[model samples]
Target: MVKQTNVKNRKLICDKLLTFQTQLEADYSDKLYEVSRKRYAQIDDLENVHTGFKSAVKREVKSLIPFSDIYKETIKLSFERVDAQYQKVEREYKEIWKEYSDNLSLNWSILAPAVEGMATFCGKVMRVLTSSNEEIDVSKLKSILYLKELNL
Candidate 1:
């Protein structure tokens, strides 16, 4: 997966990577470039991989340029870098989800008393309206179109 969840970025990265691959092949050996391309081809979602790939390529090429295609070590490092980024993104998502859940629970806890208070007030109003209490002139309230005032 890419670092970002959006579509346009993934496409841009892929395009940049393709151009970068052509340049690397021209600058370096074909075998080395092919190894890099093969490693990248395996990944399905290439979000934030552009940055990771660049870093990994720099490190790998710097270390391996003088020598022959040290295929496994060089390619594996790049793969590790990309995979690490994927893991990091997943971890970040989980942390955000946990924070959201915690906030929702806290909100429910805080609002519970307020909800109860509203219910109590509604009960008190109904009692005043229904009871023949002289203190509350219930007749002063507006009448509903189809409802007659109830006699207690």
Candidate 2:
């Protein structure tokens, strides 16, 4: 009876942990999506700025004499400014993603082994509870399993 109770306790703990893991995964996914959306929006805004500036420069140059020094200087300065802004944004985006990736790796390292252990324990229980030669299908346990994220 004590052994049975211990098994029950362990199963309960696994269920709770699995639920928590699922929630954490969902939150991480949402954060990733948000970050991607913001980054793309910034890129779109920058592209619009670049296109608008080029158009304005073209119009201004049309009013100047061909190959004028002033037109040449204006084009060079505009290109430099736009290139600097793009590089800065790219650096910031990479830094943000790098930090996120580090955290994700750390979390997975801590979490995956525990999850795998629990899954193995559950599989053993299933084996023992069924006939010796019975073929267990983990997918069929979805009704009783808390790990909705796992394909198994």
Candidate 3:
């Protein structure tokens, strides 16, 4: 058991959470989002209206589709151009999601302990400050965090 009479005796828990969130966001943007952007850059055509598709392929197909319309050939390939790159974009998107998920998992893993550690430290400090009570058993706090590995 522990006790503290003064409000100033305890540290604010909100500050710890805010710091964790800020660091997580920074790491996600730097480590995950940046890498994902690079992957997407490989497939993205930065020239014109085509964002998700390679520019050369889209331009070539667009030129051919107009002729296909007049010739009654109906290649129907222009609209389907993006479908070809769909897998690549999908892969990029998936990686980004996986990275974000990984970062979140990592953040939680670190934060859970950080918070618990602060609480434990604060508990002891306040305990000593206000009383000389015996220490409580904190075995369960050291337990592992079991998480399901989902098929991504």
TM-score of each: 0.27, 0.33, 0.24
lDDT of each: 0.41, 0.47, 0.35
Q: How would you encode candidate 1's per-residue C-alpha lDDT over 1-152 as one tens digit per residue?
A: 45566466545544443443344433323322332243222122223233434454555444433323333433454455445655665566468658865776555787878987996787567545543212222122122111122110
Please, what are the lDDT tens digits per residue for candidate 3 over residues 1-152?
A: 24553333233322332333343233323322332343233222221212322233334333433333321221233224333445555576668768875776545775888887896787666545643122322111111000011100
- What does the lDDT come to for candidate 3? 0.35
Report how far residue 47 has shifted in candidate 3, in Å: 13
The residue pairs found clashing in candidate 2 are none
| Collision count for each candidate, in order | 3, 0, 0
Residue 60 error for model 3, in Å? Answer: 6.1
Best by TM-score: 2
**Taking the tens digit of each residue's C-alpha lDDT, what string does model 2 give over 85-139?**
5566567767986896577655577788888799778756654553123222222
* Stretches of model 2 off by over 4 angstroms after superposition: 1-67, 105-152
Comparing 1 and 2 on lDDT, the stronger one: 2
| Candidate 2, lDDT over the whole model | 0.47
